[model samples]
Target: MPTPHRPSAPPAGRVDAIVLGTSAGGVEALTHLLPTLPHDFRPALLIVVHLPRHLPSLLVEVFSVRCRLPVHEAADKQPIQPGTVYFAPPNHHLLVDRDARGPSLALSADAPVHFSRPAIDVLFESAAAGYGKRLGGVILTGANADGALGLQAVKRRGGVTLVQEPSTARAPTMPQAALAAGEVDFVLPLEQMPAVLRAWGDGGAI
Candidate 1:
């Protein structure tokens, strides 16, 4: 077997999971960010986006084709795994179970937060509670302030938080909100986010 690249083993302050929140212009941002990663990129990623409850999700289809990582819609109680990507299906709240030995998914019909069913705050808060400092959060391009508070929650839990820089985003609202709400560890453009996250996945990308 080929030896693993030393840098790929897991970075300092290594994070095992990432939770992303995006909206409005997210598809374009995600398109760029997902396609560039290596298949073995270490962090298990979960994401949420606002969508109509009745509509089917194209996110899984889109990212699966665009990303090297395996991608799918989250199923209730499914355990979180490394080397994969999961997207919250339209209409439900997607949450992470904090139990490390048995990290799991939770689906809920809880009323929408920030007018979104799969609200960013719900995902981030759950992830914070579950993963604590092992989690990393990114608030990408969007039309609303949904992710700002959630990103704060992640920071409060000692997890790293990142926000897409407003000027670089296709939609500036969400990123702006996140930045305005609290300080984040990283403020990156779309192109840099994947690289930054990949660096975090392996070892310190700082």
Candidate 2:
């Protein structure tokens, strides 16, 4: 794996899960980012992308073709598994919650935040509550400010926070908002993010 030239000291805890949020240019961005993660990458990945609630998402199919890791549309109560990538199903908010059996996925039809049912904020905030210091939150290319507060929540809970550098993003609004909100741990280009994530997946000592 490539060495991560992080902006700050990497989080000391093992990252149990990674939550990523993106909109506008998400497909293009993820197309580059997901393929770089090895098949054996250990942290579970959860993602949210803004889409029309009435339409079916082809994200799982499209990403599975490029990503080495297994990809699935997140299901309610599904157990979180290492090396798997879960995408929020259209119209539902995807959340992570710890139960007697460990961390599991939850789907909510609750009101949308920032006009999105599968809001990035909901997922990141829920994951922050569930994983605390063990979670890693990524805010990538998007046209909205949905993820800013959520990234802050992750940082407040002591989780690592990564924001795509606005200069390199197809849509800088989301990352810019996150940076403006403060407490972001890393501001990196798309290429570097996978390596940083891989290092964290490999137990964080790169």
Candidate 3:
């Protein structure tokens, strides 16, 4: 495989939150990534993984056991907590909101973008607007082009963007689409992601 890409310069600031999006092969991909985050990992993680709209998601239960950090299905209006991982509930669109109390999660029933309700684009775009340069956006394996524009929005707002190396992905279309949209900070294999995320969360050079 080709060498992974890294940014020319280290990121400028701490990443307060990370927005992750995926679909096909997402469960296995997340299993590899999230469990590697140390218990004290500083940034909050908001994740969107495509799921059957009618069935309840078991992501929280599944990851809570594997990850050292707290994991929950995102609740409407729940405050974003550092070190925790929140997955968008089935059938709902997850978004980021900021208010006097600070940043929180928001769920929407509005029409899906790219035919997925918990669309990667919805979460990524909202996080870009809410957290701006303090946010980090990651696009992993998926079958379609859901996350491309959202990752573009992250780059436009001066946030850090990362995509799984397309050749290493179980389903490459999503990552490929994200790469086609524009430049990103990194294109890494899943094995390398946790370290970079740790560096970003710790406000250190990667």
Per-model TM-score, in order, reads 0.91, 0.93, 0.94
lDDT of 1 by residue, 87-189 (tens): 9988899998756567888889999998899999999999988888888999999999998998999999988888988999888999999999988999987
> TM-score of the candidate numbered 1?
0.91
Please give, for residues 1-206, the per-residue lDDT of candidate 2 as tens digits.
97785656555436989999999999999999999999889999999999999999999999998989999999999999998999999999999989889999999999989999899999999999999999999999999999999999999998888999999999999999999998787899998898789877776665
Q: Where in model 2 is the C-alpha error above 4 Å?
A: 1-13
lDDT of 3 at 201: 93
lDDT string for model 3 (1-206, tens) is 96564566555447899999999999999999999999999999999999999998999889999999999999999999999999999999999999999999999999988999989999999999999989899999999999899999988998898999999999999999999999999999999999899988987778
Clashing pairs in 1: 10-202, 11-202, 11-203, 98-130
Cα deviation at 35, candidate 3, in Å, is 0.6
Q: How many clashes (backbone N, Cα, C below 3 Å) per candidate?
A: 4, 0, 0
**Candidate with more favorable, higher lDDT: 1 or 3:** 3
Return the lDDT, model 3, position 41.
Answer: 95
Model 2 worst lDDT window (10 residues): 5-14
TM match of model 3 to true structure: 0.94
